[model samples]
Target: MATRWGLCGAGKISHDFSVAMKTLPPGDHQIVAVAARSLERAREFAKKHSIPKAYGSYEELASDPEIDMVYLGVLHTEHWRLGLLVLQAGKNMLCEKPFAMNSREVGDLIAASKKSNVFLMEAIWSRCFPLHREVRRLLAEDAIGDIKLVKASFGSPQLHIPRSVEKELGGGALLDIGVYTLQFVLMVFNGERPESIHATGVLLNSGVDESMVVVMKFARNRLAFCFFSIAVSLPNDATISGTKGTIRVLGPMHCPTTLEVNGKTTQYPLPEPSLPLNFTNSTGLRYEAEEVRQCLLKGLKESPRMPLSESALLTEVMDECRKQVGVVFNQDSQ
Candidate 1:
């Protein structure tokens, strides 16, 4: 049976997601509807994607019986509220990254998912890439022995983007792009919580972080360093060094299609999408969509690869990082 999807936002990310869904077999995935803040916008997105239904309100989408899952791709600040609505409405959800503004929101959504007995996943699309999977396999095989240090950075000059700079909108380099680097570090360390965290950053005039450098010390003297920025351009690559060898994830770390193991480069190309994507390599989203379908078919409430626990941990790490760097969101006090 095809897992029907109802998209909860009509933005560029949602558009990319819808386009990526088209890359999969129609028999396995179907976008049944889309909802946006404005009815006209929803209708336009629906028309663009050829979806069967369009809703002006997210509540309408959540209550939809035809939708097996809801993809919440709204702004960072809205995830908690919208996520709870979907889970409470008895719908599975694949929420976009920085799952919520803080760990408190993540906890509430998680509890709601358990209470509703529905599948819920944080849409950290990078973890689903073929390149990431291969990296995991190599790590498991001890290709990079001991795993001494992991370094990653993701930076883009997004000073002109309102959503990337506004504090009220939950804008900041840490929450926006740092999540990818943090998740990458955690993934390399097998989701183990770090023993200590140190973060320093440059905050915009709005009091949100413009650039951040974080160092985490994990078990057995293992260390991970991450640099994220919206004010500057960075190498945007990741390197993992071990006692024996090294593995490097090439630039555009969020959705990379290439990796270098001990200086030997290999590429994992993405599937072609019918529509042009707003983001790079978004067709790789098919992997996560397929994972959701398979998990739903098997009656699972969460994905093993991107578990709810990991989401919580990732959010907690971000929370600590923000606290250390003095980036405060409105939701933090609530």
Candidate 2:
């Protein structure tokens, strides 16, 4: 069945999602409609992407019964509203990361989804990559024994837009790049919410976090140190160190372009990806799309692979961390 898709924003990341749908397995997915704040922008995106419909308002696209799913690539603060719109429209929703500004909004969205009987998920994307899946399998197989410490970080210096620091839009490293870093911790530790957390960061001029470091502790004495920043980009990576061996993710850890294992000071490559993986252009979007397809086909509302509980927990972690770090978004304090 070809899943007709409605894209709910014409942003850069949304454009990437559109591109990824183009590469999906034939008859699996297609972009049927595109919507933006304005009809002109929506028409332009529709024309560029060869979409059949363009709407000025998100409601129009969401209410379109032909759209099987809606992918939201809007502002961070807008995710919750747009997700609710799509869900209430009787369509599955794949929202951009951060899911919502806080756990409260996420909880609200989750409840609405359940009430509406619609599928809803955050668009983390990184959790579905083949290399990362192999990494998860390796840890399960005891390739790395008794995980001890893990570190992950991602950032880009180019996103200097004023909105990046604007607390109103929920713009910050934790919501942006930090989502991927936390994925590393969640993946290795089986999505266990941290028992304890302490985080600190420097806020930008508009009071959003520019850089942040969070420390988390989980089951069986496992620990993770996650870092993120927009002030300056540094390495943008993740490392898993276990008792027996270590695994170093070779790409921003978001869409690892490579992975390496360490053996007594010797380093070697893990198996290269089998199918063509999207890193730069798509950033693992295709894999997530596949995950969603499988989940929908199986009649599942929440993904066991990326459950809503973890999604809420991650935001809670960030909320607590942001509080401790004194990184306050304008809307958060309201």
- Point to the candidate with the largest lDDT: 1
Cα lDDT, all candidates: 0.94, 0.80
Worst 10 residues of 1 by lDDT: 279-288
lDDT of 1: 0.94
* Residues 1-334, model 2: lDDT tens digits: 9877889999888777777766666589888899999999999989987899999999999899898788888998888788888887788888888898888888888888898888888887877777777787888898988899999988777456755767786777888788889877987888777788888788777777889888998878888998888878777778999998898886557866577777432222323333343346373577788888888898889777778988888888878988987876655655
Off by over 4 Å in 2: 263-283
TM per model? 0.99, 0.92
Q: Model 2, residue 133: what's the lDDT?
A: 73
**Model 2 Cα displacement at 228 (Å)?**
1.5
Error of 2 at 262 (Å): 3.1
Largest TM-score belongs to which candidate?
1
